[model samples]
Target chain A: MPKEKAITAEMLTKRFGDFIAVNAISFEVDKGEIFGFLGANGAGKTTAMRMFCGLSLPSSGKATVAGLDIYKDNEAIKQRIGYMSQKFSLYEDLTVKENIRFYGGIYGKSDTYIKKETEILLHQLELEAQANTLVGALPLGWKQKLAFSVAIFHQPDIVFLDEPTGGVDPVTRREFWNMIYEAAAKGITVFVTTHYLDEAEYCDRVSIMVDGVIAALDTPAALKKQYHASGMDEVFQQLARGAKRQDN
Target chain B: MKQFLSFVKKEFLHILRDKRTLFILLGMPIVQIIIFGFALTNEVKNEGIAVLDLAKDQSSGELIRQMDASRYFELRAYLQNEQQIEKTFLKGQIKLAVVIPPGFDHQLRHTNKAQLQLIADASDPNLANTMVNYAGSIVQQFQSTIFPQQQAAYQIQTELRMLYNPQLKGAYNFVPGVMAMVLLLVCTMMTAITIVKEKESGTMEIMLVSPLVPFSITLAKAVPYLLLSIVNIISILLLSVYVLDVPIRGSVLLLIGMSILFTMVSLSLGLLISARSSSQQTAMFISLVGMFLPTVMFSGFMFPIENMPKPLQVISNIVPAKWYYIIVKSVMIKGVGFNAIWKEALILAGMCTFFLAMAIRNFKIRLA
Candidate 1:
């Protein structure tokens, strides 16, 4: 019961001019669970994530991450959550080890802690050989994995991966999910947004957003059964098609 | 503070690894100093003159000899008639024409008065005025020599000594101005473009999301350039001292401190520009077009602000470089201390505070 909620949202809405990007969407994410935020492009997944990450203000709603107010305690929330942008957000000119040290330094980690964590992370990814090479020279899969590791290097309460595995081979994607599963197993909450429906099966709960509104929010199995579908893809297609029908 | 240092270290790495930025930051100051020191001199030399000696006498001959010996004029031809004078001048072959009348020697002996005509090509009015003035002075010197008693009766004696730069070398004026310009270009333009590049590359978002405050991020971007600008100042001073022979007569520490202060003002201006500009090209264009000409023209670099129109003189008062130039001229050229330059220093410090506040306010608004 104590771990039943990691995030709470009540009628969270964000608008730009007359256009509403997130329209009264609300959901809860449990602790130590992988929550999948699935949406087509322009469905406001990034905007909602930005609000949840305390990057932008919600127009007329309330949200809390790690029990901190999004408005008054944004700095506190920022210290407790980690974010890895869709755009590979590591210093391309810095080495993998240096990037880790830089992030750890900003988080006020001791130099000894940084050195130990850097060795462990590099050894875990088997990228110890590239410790001195610039991150820009690394392969895309390695960069994504390294960026994710750096994002959560300080072991925040929750890690927000905004499409962390966008452009990678299936094998690399599988490896990336393994890293995510390991982190989740360690009692860290994972909030991820992705276009890959098959990856939804890996999540403890999934939400399908269509036109700035959540059409379904439940466990992947429950969502499939509720939509009378066999998998997450059919549930998404049904929800999207239903939304399009409602729009016309 | 530790976080700020690490961020600044990363910025230095970015500047060092990028060859183009490195070249612009380090190479431009020395190159600009050399160009402004040697190539852009205002000294007029070896101007061509055509002499029409109708007297064909010793006095006229002696006047022509003195003109040739003075090195200010090279007698290109001797004109026989007024028609020839017009032809030579129209052909662009002569910049000045000296016409001595037939009765020149008789008039000097009897009436103690001689007449000479100096006609200069006015197409290039500045050079023409300089050439005509030199020619008239040479004639007056000859008249004084031949009739020292007569000169004592009707002569006006004057002694003029040019201070700071005895020869009135243009390099002495331009060296400090070029330092101001080069520092502005390197500190403001480079910082603006580099910060905009971070935004464009999406790296700024990453830095912003981290625990580093926005002010620390901006400070990190500025400190490296501040150090580099100081290095440039030293290089310019060394070049001026050894190569151009322009003296740094005041306390070196004061000159350096003023340079660093000006560099900070420029860096903050760049920050303000970068905060408003979303793209590197826009940032670069804003710094170059917005800051360059004003620093060069209105800062008393090319034209003296005292002689400028009243409106422009008032406008120049607002330019921080104008105050910096005054501070530098007072310190490096005039050998004055803080007492002599406290007013200009106060103006520069006020400008620095204004720019720093504006940049901080702009940054906050941007984040909001």
Candidate 2:
């Protein structure tokens, strides 16, 4: 079976009254592809991500995610997609098992699926003993690992992870990418945002957002060769600096 | 509905898991009720008094017995001299001193009148005034008994009819306002903090991205606090009626209904505060500085609204607790039905709706 497009946006824009936070931007992602979204602070990457994730409506744009309208079928889009923010937004007071059941139930997954999937997940992650413990007691690495597992537990078509591996040790970051690779191998589209340029090398395709517009979107190696930059970090600095000095 | 129930259950777990907050939530009202009920009454009891009876006669001794019989005065010492009386007052041992001049039975028989002096430590003006009036009334009674032939027509007697609270219990004044203050603190502070907590921890973002409608999210946040505030009202009612001897003169159902309406107003106001604040500390600060003080000061809880400056009296009209205090007093103390308190009740319900609408607007604006 031929794979289809998972995400498509055309001239998507978001404005905050006097500020055009996300100027007209557009992009597309193929199914089962791991797409890296790179941007500097205040580059409007978050605003565009919010528009795609249905957290905010577009000021003017046309977009579809998981084959559903971003404007009319926002609720439907929520069920087909998963989002994990940088803050690791899990209930610290709730036990690990409770958080799993809570997210599963919210996604409208069946009870039998939740039970069967929860057991498999606990065993696969080697967290059976800690399943009943509050997530607050877990170390940062373990919490992030658990959060990622829960975020993808419902088998979403596309999972939007906004800087998911932020603030973790290098070894843990490597292991977290292994999990992302594993999810992609299952034919789930991985749409991620990250500032760690070295991690950008792991993406199948990279889109660098500068000043609310996509300055570059292609394979990292192709972009590196095109810009004559030996590393993804240099490539990012070149694009980021261009926008800062644009109007000046 | 399932989503809302799960959300409410999660909130309850948060409430029950934190032992310190649980202690505060359950402990504060009971402690406040006890403090206001037993410790802060206006009626004087077991106050100390000293007597300086220079006359070694039957009439002087009769006056002393009259004072000792009343519940208000406890005779502390029979002073040997005026110096002894002043020293006793300085020690804080007695609030009042009654002096009988040396001519007691002889002067009463010869002149048909005896001069008596009453000395009071007026440090606490209210207590001192009440004690002196108590002593003066007892002396006047003694004089009347000793001389029946003298009923002066020119002597004006002040007939004080304490209407609702005949004994003038301060608990009568405080219990209703405590309801206002407690519900305001519990519903407003708790709901505000709970909502801001989700925002601060970044969980609100995830919830917003999920399938739950904003309305359901709001209702879910409000449900647990609503139930808890209702429990608060009942506990306060139990404490006031059984423990404090405060009567619920009107229908029990009506009091509960008014309480529920007032709590909704408090909860929506809390939601409004939560929508404005981004952190728990800011929400708590607004709840305390904004809602708590106004409820205490302008609601006529501690001071009567009639006595406040005209400007403050006008400001008091905007405080939801001001109307709630009136309803509590009317339905609980005055025992009047809904007909009498319908206007206050309607105003409170209107405040609830107005706050709810404003909170929804604020919340949606922040989300967008």
Candidate 3:
């Protein structure tokens, strides 16, 4: 049986003035799958994600998120999806508990639900002692973890993580991946974009965008075998080098 | 609405945590008010004068004595001749010199009209004009005293009643103007900077991706500043009424309602600035050079708009603070109600609507 589409795009494009940021791209993310969006710096990954999240409108083409029209039902779609940006998006001035409460409240969660979830979240992260401390005073690793947790605090159907673990220790990055896995276990679709080829291997399926176009999309193992590469890293390098050769 | 409340609560926490910002919000207004009230003034006193009495007669001597007795002029020295007048002024010791021509008493008694040459330093034109006026008033008083029977010809009777501030107290004028200025600075500039900070931090993108609508996000950001500005207005009113003895002769509720309206206008202006600026520094610059300068300069705080150049006076109409200042003065000083200040109030409300509409449109364009 074919996978159920959680997100769909058909020739979606975004342009700023005369410059095209995200060229025509078409893809779909299945429900409850970890979909990795891989791209080099300035390959238009962020722009595409922004369009998918309904923060930016496509210059042309049609897209739907969670079965709702992107343009007409953006608000409804936003309520059903979580988003974490490359920068840790939590308010640095607010405490951990306060941040959770704020995000939860914004998602229209009840006060009691927020209070209960706050306790559970703090306990799970082992950050109960630092609950009242400001987020700015926390370490970067902890901030990244807390930001991921806050993004999914409302238990949305899909969580969009835009380069979620950019700067962290290897151990912390592994631990953050465990959290992502735990969310996926609860049947939450994880739409992630990252530069780490090793991290792409952990995704159920991955898509590589090169020069505003998806050059490759498949399971990491399948992609490596098809490209005759040793690992995901070699596969990505081979695809990028092939694009450069074609341009020449 | 729940999302907006949470966003507003977060904004309050941000403001509370930033100690420097809090100090600027609460401290700058009071400091500005005190400085303007005490240190800045248009009134002049104790100007230095030199006497050049070429006619060494009793009447000239009496006039010199009268000039010395008056508090407005301080007798610096007696000049030797007309040539010394320039030297004395160049030294900067005296601002004016009285040159009594030869045979001054003889001419006054014979012709009943005497000419007194009053030369003044005109480097600072305002001070020069004031000094000249003071000297003329003193001479007229002396002439009246010397020839009371000739008052029919030299009759110059005038009654001066300084309305609102009988003593022309600086606080009476500055308190309300400071209220207008501080409210504008805190409400508009601070809101713009905070919103721009969010954009710089990349948190605004995250928030935008959430379920919150653009209107909800902007309205949330505006709420905290609106509340804080109202509190600031209260503090300013209390300070003016209690500390400066500047009474609010009109209804307090009306004053507060007008303040809130003005604050909305200022906040919308800030939102407009934030929508255009991509960075915090750019927002700060726009607020300081664009909003702050006009609020202080043309809001009847430093320079009276009526006394300004006609073009500048016309330009002040665009500044929201100008209308707020007039409304405040009418309510606080003139003891007028909405019936008298309705036009200014209406202008402020219209400006608020226009700014808010522009901000909403800009937000939509940015999203697109």
Candidate 4:
């Protein structure tokens, strides 16, 4: 049997009054694949992700998320995907368990499911002792990890992480990436955007976006070989240096 | 519905955990009621007045006694000379000085005319005006009683009776004002700030990505404040009735029904503000300066809308609080029923629909 395509886009373009925020871009991600969307600031990475997440509309494009048409089934797309941004999404005022239950509840999980998952999540994260503690009292790394856990708690078909590891220490970023790996291992497609090029090496396949268009798309090793670079960072710099847009 | 309930539960948690928000939500109405009820009253009573009796006669003495006996004035000082009147006023001891001109009992019996002058301190113009009016009325009453049988030709005795508020109590005027203010503040400001706070914390993006529709998300955010404002209305009405001694003359059901309608208006206004504002500070600023100020200025509670300029009078019609204030005053003070206030209530309902539609429309535009 052929592998399922979790997301597919063709000729996707978004314009904001004469400025092409997202130029025509085509891509595909298989089910359970970790796809890294890399770009410089203002390269339209966020606009593209927003379209896929049903947060925005494309001026003209063809796209589907989780096998649902983006234009006709925008709402259905939202149902099957989860999103976490750079800023922490969990309520700091709520306890760790309350935060988990609230998110699970909004996702239409049954009370029994939320209860069972709350226990399982607490034990998995080794936060059983601090389950009743307010999320504000938790350290930054723990908050980021918990945010990621809540995002995937609904068992979404794909989880979109936008700069999820921004501002974290290297060790915490590694731990966060481990969680992403675990989610992918469970057959959840991971669609992530990142500023750190080194993190691109962890993805199953990567696409470099420059000036609202994809300049390269391949595994990190293949991109390095094609650009004659030593690492993913050199590969990204080689493609990004040709961009015409100013820093945003 | 389960999703919405969970969302509202989360909102309640946010509100309950934040001590400051809880304090403001629960404390503001009671504080405003007390402050407006007792301290910021417009009713004047027992004002100090000096009597300069130049005529030492039975008529003069009788008139003097009557003026002092009336609850409107307190005879504080007896002045000997005209100069003493100015000195007494300068000392801030008297608001008005009554001058009974030198005359014998012969002036009333022979001439049937006597002169009386009321000198009032005009420093505080409103107080001076009221004091002068009170003293003038007392003199007229004395004149009518002294010569009841000898009726002057073409004399017109005008009887003035203040209806609804016969005692002219200031509480009757401000109780409704306080209610409008408290409900609008708690509903509009709190709703706007709470929604914008989600935007600030980055949770709004996550929420938009969820299976839950935007309408349900916005409604869930407003539901808690909607319930909170009803509690506010009940507390305000109870305080006005029991502690402040302002009567709820009309049907209690009508009052509550109209108040909930006004709360809906305010909540919709809050939704509109939240849709436009991206930050909590911006939402607060708009709610206070843009919304609260207009509620005070044009609501006909703090300021008389009839006395305003024509342009402002036109603008006042658009403020939902103005209609709410009118309905409350008519229903609570005048003891009027739904028949009397249906027009104002209709206007409020229309405003609620308009604002809610605008808010929902703006929210949809944002997604595009």
lDDT of 3 by residue, A1-248 (tens): 12367888889998879767678899888889999999888777888988888878899988888878888988898899999988878888899999999999888898889999999999999999999999999999999999999999999988999999998888999999999999999999999999999999999999998877888999998999999988999988887764431220
lDDT, ranked from best to worst: 4, 2, 3, 1
Quote the lDDT for A126 in model 3. Answer: 100
In model 1, state the lDDT of residue B18: 82
| lDDT winner, 1 or 3 | 3
Q: Write the per-residue lDDT of candidate 2 for residues A121-208, one digit (tens) a residue.
A: 9997889999999999999988998989988988999999989988999999999999999999998999999989999999999999
lDDT of 4 by residue, A102-220 (tens): 99989999999999988988998899999999999999889989999999999999999998988889999999999999999999999999989989999999999999999999999
TM-score of 2: 0.92
Minimum summed lDDT over a 10-residue window in model 2 chain A is located at A239-248
Ranking by TM-score: 4, 1, 2, 3
Q: After superposing candidate 1, which stretches have Cα over 4 Å from the reference? A: A1-4, A242-248, B52-57, B75-94, B100-111, B147-150, B364-368
Candidate 4: Cα lDDT at B138: 84
Which model is ahead, 3 or 4, in terms of lDDT?
Answer: 4
What TM-score does chain B get in every candidate? 0.92, 0.93, 0.83, 0.92
**What's the lDDT for candidate 3?**
0.87
Model 3 chain B: worst 10 consecutive residues (lDDT sum):
B37-46
Report lDDT (Cα) of residue A111, candidate 3. 89
TM-score leader: 4
Considering TM-score, which of the candidate structures 1 and 2 is the better prediction for this target?
1
DockQ of 4: 0.66
Tens digits of per-residue lDDT, candidate 1, A175-202, equal 9999999999988899999989999999
Error of 2 at A210 (Å): 3.2
